[model samples]
Target chain A: MLKLLTFVKNCKEGVLRATPKKPRETRRKKILQTALEILPQRGFDGITLESIADALGYTKPAIYYYFKNKDDLVCSLVTDYLKDAHQAICAITDGNGSPKERLIRIIHFYVDRNCEQRGYFTIDHHLGGVLRKMPHTAEADNLRKLSLEIPSRLIKLINEGIQLGEFRDEDPAVLGSLIFSLLGGVLTHMEMPSLASLGVEGLKQRVCDFALKGIVV
Target chain B: MLKLLTFVKNCKEGVLRATPKKPRETRRKKILQTALEILPQRGFDGITLESIADALGYTKPAIYYYFKNKDDLVCSLVTDYLKDAHQAICAITDGNGSPKERLIRIIHFYVDRNCEQRGYFTIDHHLGGVLRKMPHTAEADNLRKLSLEIPSRLIKLINEGIQLGEFRDEDPAVLGSLIFSLLGGVLTHMEMPSLASLGVEGLKQRVCDFALKGIVV
Candidate 1:
């Protein structure tokens, strides 16, 4: 426990120290953080780098030092979020267990990660139509590409299960896409009458059960 | 052949003449037809009575003769769309085919319906805010209700299949939601990059193969 606590304290110090360590880097991080937080509140069409800089108590040039433009800042936020998701999904999948157990844990982590970062959905995902001619356009495309990879890995598990005759045959690529839907279906109810009618735990179970039912031998 | 040809002409004439036949009613149908054509290009925010009227060579008051207000018009659209969807889904589900086949056909219809009516997804769909305190919000709320009903119906199908010993024992509701995701997964690829990769016919076949692989006996 002492060692774990020591390690955590060091980690926190490393993260804090990593920030504001360099003048240009600090401004970049600040700009990206501001974009990540504010994009959800105002739709993408309404956001400007000037507004983001003003919100952070910085000059436009200060932000320009960190990001080339508004889309660049958004691309960075999207990229960072994708990297975090990829790492989380990878950690869950790397564990040694039956695919069923692994997937349950992954689904649980997936939902928790979503709730933990619900703000990103509103910010980075509104309309999802970033303007062309931005330098980070390729990177933004890659972030979405990364988003697709997590499900691909999950589908790979289902494919393996089928090969072992422990699960029924299913198209893994399509199965991966469906898992994404099950994962996000509750968002469909956000505007409905009962906000709390279908709880998160219940929604997750629905996804897990849906996945297993189609495949169990 | 003569009788069949007459039946076809009669059906077409009936659709055209089933209208309220009132001069005022023509304005309403004209408005809705215009809205369907233009709204997808411009989103909910992009539509207004004046714009629709301009497109139809009428004045705002002329359009209002049919709809009370913008809200009334939207509610009418929602009601009409849902009625059509319910009818389309019901036709497949009325004991005409096997459970697996019915599920596939219905799921295909749901996905295809969206492709044809991309207007529903053009905006953020923030109805919680849109419907708040509005008198006609019930129409939009019903759309939300249908989201749940859709999965519930699928669960019923899975339960029937399992009881008939066609599928393995698994939770039905969960499976139903999964089936939704399998089809719902198409939303992620609406933009040009992904959209171009998935040509129209390519997606239809993908949905078919995906559904059968998951549920085939």
Candidate 2:
């Protein structure tokens, strides 16, 4: 009976310890979610921790406890986003069919992701300029490295495609870079008054077709 | 003798009137040139009238005499660039062999201009985001309209290409946008370490080839 009592007491203590962490995690996610929504419209300079806190109806200190500052919050947001994007890309590139097929899948993946989380990309592109001007931090360095890796990995895939005769024998480096530029341009101008009729899926199909034709034999 | 004296007097007055205006025009050009040099490196936020004056060894008041403020200065620079670019594009589109030939010429023109004046393009791109958050000014609105016209003109050309059956019967809007994205992607990543070996001419050739292949029958 004493042993049973001790076990019950330990179980209650364990739940008490675990419950606080869940809300903290939940709160951190909520902060990131709110920031993502505001970021595309306001940009990096326009957003403030106070603004984000106000949007969430939380106190400044509540946000501070979760994020060190605005940069920290943005870095966290980008890092989380890059981590997931990198993983998805790797899974696609590593677990793929022919190089051309993988490349097509990547185009679909990139367009779909941009369509869904355009704010992240707008902020990401803006961050490219912002990070260049600011003093380098470890976090900024990691973000830069992560951003470069995506392109380099795609370039590698393009190189593989060229070697296997799946793609035309063009400079993969140039081809890869051009493909990225094309996708970015589409994203940049996706909201043109004329393009509204295509919707997301239609836009994706056109982008994939255009991008593939440039590279295919 | 009286007629000769009168002619000399008129000549003297003409020189006196032209002298100060010449220097004033030259000084304004100098200010715009210096800002162009600094803007791509520092972006819109990092530049100021004082910093520009410092670079030019002129007083801040001297810059003020020429520009009302930073936005005014940037607007002037962009306006000058757009006017020239629009005229050049119009010339090419108007005096071309075929739509495909005209499109190829445009790709070359764009790539060459970007290579020569990379800073202007970079700052112009950064301004797209900056203009969005700030209160709308007439100057900003004009800049936005001018920027939109470049692509719209190209889209019109693509539509012409489709109608003439020189290019594939794809959505002209989609094709034009994708072509722009491809060229822009080239500009964005033109400085990548891997792409360094391909000189400007080589890069332009590759870009034109890739772009034309996508839309040409």
Candidate 3:
């Protein structure tokens, strides 16, 4: 009984630590990475803290030490995913080349990430409906904001492209929406037998070719 | 007791008619139409036979007479909606004018349908996820086939456009997927405040303009 009490105390203290200790943070990252690896194979409903723990060869309590529950883990995973994607996109937008060049890079960035993280995109698409049904949480709000911000950044870049005569003079908002739509559709249908035969490089080339031609002067 | 037996007899007879009697068929159509009218406003969860009946000044039994239950009603509604859309698209595809003109008509058809029947599209979007989760039914099978057929038709038109040099040389399948993605994305985001301001015609023009520019030779 005393040993059990000590273990419980230790887990609670680990969760409440002001800053996650280094080893604990590493384990947490591993847990999230493993969760993503398993997601596409098993789907959202099939994943659980216990399953993730089992995959990592850790105990369930070890998983819970970092995340309060499954929702906490999933929420953090999505938040981090979006944060990383947003930062990458922003960097491209803020970097060298002209608006058109940056736009092409952004398209490539999206396609590459999507092809590499097929599981994440599948989960993200499913989450679109699920998140709307969920009550507003700080996590959900942050996610919504990040999702909107990424596209808005692209829209701003398109505006710059138009001003510089790199892209046709058109409503940037409309163009951005259409481009994103094309990306979303392609990503959603990537697994279709017909498209799958094109392989990654072929798919990337087609998307970039279609999207760039749609806007470029 | 005799009157109750007669009422049951009449209802069962109404359902069993070999070719639906005019009155019964008209009433069944009314039930389906009213369900659609209520679907967007109330959503799938909020809608029920009772609500649809109340809207149409009929009893729940009047609904059950045509549909076995809520699922039957929804399945029929989806089947009818897709059938109608598929037939209309075929008509346009088979009609006069260049491939470009027909493609534009198809886009217009989609935009116009989506705008006018906002409820249907909303329900359809929600149903995309729902249908996947559902066990396969004949209705589900039909709906799936029709959905694929519509896109296949578009792909064929794109191929014709390329052959005629009306469109640039590219994979018709890839282009078709991209175009559908654009249309799907636009329809999905139609309610966003940013795009809503564009109004229906403005939105239609943008879709056609961007899509045509992408492939036009």
**TM-score of each predicted structure versus truth:** 0.60, 0.86, 0.79
Residue-wise lDDT of candidate 1 within B35-101, one digit each (tens)?
A: 8777776666678888899999988887887789887877666556656766776676665767777
- Estimate every model's Cα lDDT from 0 to 1: 0.63, 0.80, 0.81
What is candidate 2's lDDT per residue for B131-211, written digit by digit as tens? 564458887777777777777788889889899988899878778877877777678778876555688888878888888
Chain A, model 2: TM: 0.86
Per-residue lDDT of model 3, residues A125-157, tens digit only: 665654565558776987877877887899889
lDDT of 1: 0.63
Best by lDDT: 3
- DockQ of all predictions against the true structure, Cα-based: 0.16, 0.56, 0.52
Q: After the best TM-score superposition of candidate 2, give how far the Cα of residue B63 lies from its true spot, in angstroms.
A: 0.6
DockQ winner among the candidates? Answer: 2
Candidate 2 per-residue lDDT, tens place, A82-179, comes to 88878888888888598888888888887788788777676656656665754588877887888778777898899999998888897787788778
- Model 3: residue B156 alpha-carbon error in angstroms: 2.4
Winner on DockQ between 1 and 2 is: 2
Q: List clashing residue pairs in candidate 2.
A: A181-B185, A182-B181
Interface RMSD per candidate: 4.7, 1.5, 1.4
